[model samples]
Target chain A: AQRVTQPEKLLSVFKGAPVELKCNYSYSGSPELFWYVQYSRQRLQLLLRHISRESIKGFTADLNKGETSFHLKKPFAQEEDSAMYYCALSFTYGSQGNLIFGKGTKLSVKP
Target chain B: DAMVIQNPRYQVTQFGKPVTLSCSQTLNHNVMYWYQQKSSQAPKLLFHYYDKDFNNEADTPDNFQSRRPNTSFCFLDIRSPGLGDAAMYLCATSSHRESYEQYFGPGTRLTVT
Candidate 1:
């Protein structure tokens, strides 16, 4: 069974401060991790994936195989960055397109 | 623009009544998925269609059903709505059935009364 755990339910930070959202996964096979974001009055969209290794909106996540973690980080947070972030894991074997998501973390960037 | 679209942004259904949620995509993706997201919880996969092939989760209740008439459209049918069934139902599409980046719709909020 593939499982994703997001430790924080709510994270508050001041504008221009660094922010990190923790995520951990438990999967036997090679996992494909992704970060999805949902802003107020917006649909859930893919922020980035471990395979892409590309930063989106100044946010980046590194997948650590040894620690089984994929933490999302941003050097400087903006007030518009306030949103709900979800970490997801995917297994290619049986459930191909289905994503196992973690309970989302609500990020509040105060100005 | 190529995107996933879900109909009826909000739905109100009576308990024990059947409700259907529709999803369409202009992306022409081969895979479409349905997910149930409860308040403060992650979106859980209910089922998916890979080029017309239906795959349902093992633990998904029998009350839930799905239909894929074609590549661009899919529907989720809830045979009997319950209080617990009230949640945000999300529809997503991807180009492939593997680990491709998925495009999600603005989810349909279902409220059972």
Candidate 2:
């Protein structure tokens, strides 16, 4: 079974402050992790993937296999960064190709 | 823009009434998925279509059914909606079965009275 856990349901940070959202997963096989963001009144969009190793909107996440964690972080938070973030694990084997998502974390960057 | 699209952004259906949510994609993706998300909760996978093949989650209720008439369109049909079924229905598309990135439409909000 594949499970993704997001420990924080809500995180409040002041503008220009550093922020981090925790995420953990349990899967027997190798996992492909991804971070998705949903802004207000917008559809869910892919923020970044572990494999890509790229940063978007000043946010970055690194997958740690030993710890089974993929935490998203940013040096400075902006008011526009306030949104819902979800961590997902992709089941690439057997053509399932479905994403197992975590209970999202709502980030509020107070200006 | 070439992207996934969902119809009837807001839908209201009476309890025990049947309702269908439609989705279409111009991305020419091979995989299409439907997810149900309640307030303050994660989106639950209802089912997906890999081209013409249908895959349903084990815990998905029998009252929920899906149809993919073609590669560009998919539909989620609720046989009888209940109060609990009121939520946002998200439609997503991917280029391949193993593709990591998925394109999502602005989900349809269903309200069951």
Candidate 3:
């Protein structure tokens, strides 16, 4: 079975505080992972993928094959960063059309 | 400019009513997908179209069907919507040329009475 799990349903933090949203997956084969964000009154969009390994909006995620984790982290939380974050996994590495998303985490950054 | 578009952002339909939701993408991607998201739940894949080929998820109900008459347009039709069928329907697109990115549209929220 292929599944993605986000442990936190909501993460509340003060502005300028460090934020970490955890994501884990269970799959037998190699997989591609991604982090997607949806802001208030906006559509869901790709934030970053494990393959790129680049920072977006001061956020970063790393895929650890050993632990089957692809946790998203940011040094500081901003008020604008309050939104719903989803962790997704492409079941097959080569056939990348389909995605399996986790139950998202809602981050609330207080001022 | 909006790359992927879904019309009638909010729709209300009566029980057992047939409804259709439309999606269009200007990115000219070769693949398009439809997903159903219940409150606080992950978006579940309903089906997709790679060019003209349609692929439906194994557990997707037969009441839900999709059509893609052209590369840029796709439609999801619910033959008879039940109360449980009300959800946020999202449409996404990807290209074989680019393996990692998927463009999403502002989803349509369906309300069943």
Candidate 4:
């Protein structure tokens, strides 16, 4: 079956510390991957996508095909960075845009 | 600015009562989706409408139904509310051909009592 997995339920870190949130997927065909974040009392929003190969808010995610991983990384974490992060995968069907998401990881950046 | 919108940011429903959640988008995207998310869990896809075509996920329960009567609006209907169905109902929209970044609406938090 096609699935995304974020192993850590919660990751707490001090401000200015480096942080990494791991995400792995299981799929047979090529799939588009995305990292979404939800801040408290805010809507879930797109953080970044693997295809873009770009960084947002000092965060970057590298898609490692050999290991089937697309872990989100930030060299220095900030208190405002605390939020719920979800890893999602989308595949091209005949004409539908279906996304399968993993149980998210909650990151708490302490001051 | 173009964005997705969900009405009634919070909803309260009695057990066995029916509730409807509405969403609208001005992005002119061809695909719209509804997802159910509980505390600390992944957002589960309930269904989506690609243009005028409706697609439902296999595991989605029959009690959860959706309607996209037009290009700009979609509705999620819960036939009979149960305590377990209380969750954040998220509505998202993206381009038709590709599942690019989906623009999400401020979700509606449904509370069942």
Quick one: best TM-score, which candidate? Answer: 3
Candidate 3 residue B13 C-alpha distance from true site, Å: 0.8
- Residue lDDT tens for model 4, A1-111: 999999999999999999999999999888788899999988889899888889999999998989999999999999999999999988764345577889999999999
lDDT of 1 by residue, B1-113 (tens): 87889999999999999999999999888888999999999999999888978998998999999999989899999999999999999999987443567899999999999
Per-model CA lDDT versus the true structure:
0.93, 0.92, 0.94, 0.92
DockQ winner between candidates 2 and 3 = 3
Per-residue alpha-carbon lDDT of candidate 3 for residues A31-64, written as tens digits (9 for 90 to 100): 9999999999999999999989899999999899
C-alpha TM-scores of all predictions: 0.96, 0.96, 0.98, 0.94
Residue pairs in clash, model 4: none
TM-score of chain A of each: 0.96, 0.95, 0.97, 0.95
DockQ of 2: 0.61
Of the true contacts between chains A and B, what fraction does model 3 have?
0.67
Q: What stretches of model 4 exceed 4 Å from their correct place?
A: A93-96, B97-99
Off by over 4 Å in 2: A93-96
What ranking of all candidate models by lDDT puts the best one first? 3, 1, 2, 4
Question: Global lDDT for candidate 3?
Answer: 0.94
Stretches of candidate 1 exceeding 4 Å from the true structure: A93-95, B97-99
True contacts kept of each: 0.69, 0.51, 0.67, 0.72
lDDT per residue for candidate 3 within B4-78, as digits (tens), equals 999879999999999999999999999999999999999999999988989999999999999999999999999
Instruction: Give a tens-digit lDDT track for model 2, residues B1-113.
Output: 89889999999999999999999998889989999999988989999988898999999999999999999999999999999999999999987533637889999999999
For candidate 1, the per-residue lDDT at B3 reads 82
